[model samples]
Target: MRVISFINMKGGVGKTTLSTNVAHCLAVHEKKKVLLIDIDPQFNATQCFFSGDDYVKYMEDGSDTVLDLFDGDVTRVSTVRGASHKSKKCYEEIKPYKIMDNLYILPGNLNLFKIEISAGSGKENRLKKYLDVVQQLLGFDYVIIDTPPTPSIWMTSALVASNYYVIPVKPDPLSYTGVSLLQTIIDQKKEDLDLQLKFLGIILTMVEESTLVYKRCVETIKSTDNLKDYLFGNFIHKRTEIPKQQLSQSFILDLEKSELSYNLVAIIKEMIKRIERYEEHK
Candidate 1:
C-alpha cells in the first residue's frame, strides 16, 4: 500500500481540503481502497467529514477515535512473526468509520491534546507498526493521513509511517517560511530512524489564478532550484463553495460536473504518476 501524509507548517493552506478530496477521488473514481487517517490534534479533518454533534455522540457511544491508537494501553512487541504475534496493539481490530465502499476513515479527536509522551518510549513507531498489521489484514491500496500544521509527535508519527509526504503551500509569502523547517525535521527523522520517506512534491493550493500574487508565487517556485523540481504542475484554485460543501459532509467529487471536482481529479492523476515515477527510479 502507498502511505502518504498531507502536511504543511502553515495552517489554512487547504491541507484538509486537498487530502479529503484526493482520497475521495482515489476511492470513488480510481476504485482503490483507501484509509484516511486524521492525526491532527485539532481534528480539522474530522470536523470536515462529520457534523460536530454527531462526532460527539460517536465518542459518547464508545467508538474508537485516533486517540486510542496513541494513548491506548497496547504494549509494544519487538518483532512481527508473520502477522501473528503478541502485539495486541497492532493486531486488535480497529473499526474506522466507513464512508463508502472503498474508503474508511480513522477520525481525530479533541482529547488527543491531553496525552503526554516521553522520549525513548517507542511511541513514535506505534502508528507505523499498527498500520503494517492493518494494511496486511485489510488489503488497502492507499493510506492518506491528514496531519496537523505543526511539528509535533503526531506529525512525526505520520512521517515515520509514510512512504511519501506531499506538502501543501498557499500563494502566500509566509507559507514558504515553514517549508525549510519541515524539511529540517524530516531530515532529523531520517537520521534517527533511517526512514526511507520521500518528498512526493509540493502542491499549490487556495490559488487565485487571476491575481498577480498567485502568478508571482508560481513563478517564484519555478525559478527556485530546490522548490521547482518538487512543485506539482497543477494547482487547486480557491473556491468559495468548498467550505460550504465540506460543512455538509460533502466531498468536491460529489458535485460530479463541478470544475473544483475535476481540479482534484487532475491532481490525483498527477499524484499517481509521481508515485509511479518514484517506484521506477527507486
Candidate 2:
C-alpha cells in the first residue's frame, strides 16, 4: 500500500485540508480503495469526514479509535524484546468507519492527548504494525494519515509509519522558516529509524493571489534548494467558502466545484504524478 502522511510541524497550514480532499478524490474520482487515518489528537480529520452530531455520538459511544493501536490491551513487549508484534494477541481487529464505497476512516480520539509518551513506552511502531496487517487483510490502495502539528510522539509515530511525507505550508515567513527545521527532523528520523521515506513536495495553502508579500514569499521558497526540490506547483487560494463547506462537515470534492476545489484537484493530480514517478525510479 502507498501510505502517505500530510504533515508539518507548523499548524494552520492546511494539513487536514490536503489530507481529506486527496483521500476523498482518490476514492471517489480515482476509484482507489483509500483508508484515511486520523492520528491527530485534535481529530480534525475525523471532524471533516463526519458531521458534528455524528462525531459527538461516536465519541460518546466509546467507539475504537486510532488510540486503540497504541494503548487499550496492546503490549509493549515487542519493543522491549525486539520480537514481531503480530505474534502477540494484544489487540483486536479495528473496524474503520466506511465513508463511501472505496473509502474508510480510522478515527482519532481526544483521549490521545492524555496518553503520556515516555522514552521507554515503546509504542511508537504501533501504527506501522497496524498498517502492515491492514494492508494484507484489507488490501488498501492508499493510506492517508493526517498527523498532528508538533514534535510530539504522535508526529514521530506518523513519520515511522509513512512511506512518504507531504508538507503543507502557508505563504507566511513563520511557516516557511520552519521548513528547514522540519526537514532536519525528517532527515534525522530517516536515519534514526532506518526508514526509506521519499519526499512528496510541499503544498502551499491559504495563499493570496494578488498580494506582493505572498508573491515574494513564494519566490523565496522556490529559491531555497531544499524547499524547491519538493515544492508543488499548485496552491490553495484563501477562500471563505472552504470554512462554509467545512462547517457542514462536507468533503470539498463532494460539493459543487469552487476555486478551493479546483486548486485541490490540481494538487492531488500532481501528487499522483509525483508518486508514480518516485515509484518508477525505485
lDDT of 1 by residue, 1-282 (tens): 999999998899999999988888899999999999999998988887789788867765657677778776543222322222122233466677888899989899776787887655788788888788887778899999999988888888998899999999998888865687778888897788789998988898888899988877878778877678898888788888888988998888888898888878889999999999999997
The weakest ten consecutive residues by lDDT in model 1 span 77-86
Q: Candidate 2 regions off by >4 Å?
A: 73-92
Q: Tell me the whole-model lDDT of each prediction, alpha carbons only.
A: 0.84, 0.83
All models, RMSD in angstroms: 6.4, 6.0
| lDDT of each residue in 96-182, candidate 2, tens digit only | 788889999999987688788764377888888888888777889999999999888898888889999998988888888888899
Best by lDDT: 1
Model 1 has an lDDT value of 0.84
Per-model TM-score on C-alpha atoms: 0.91, 0.90
Give the lDDT of residue 49 in candidate 1: 76
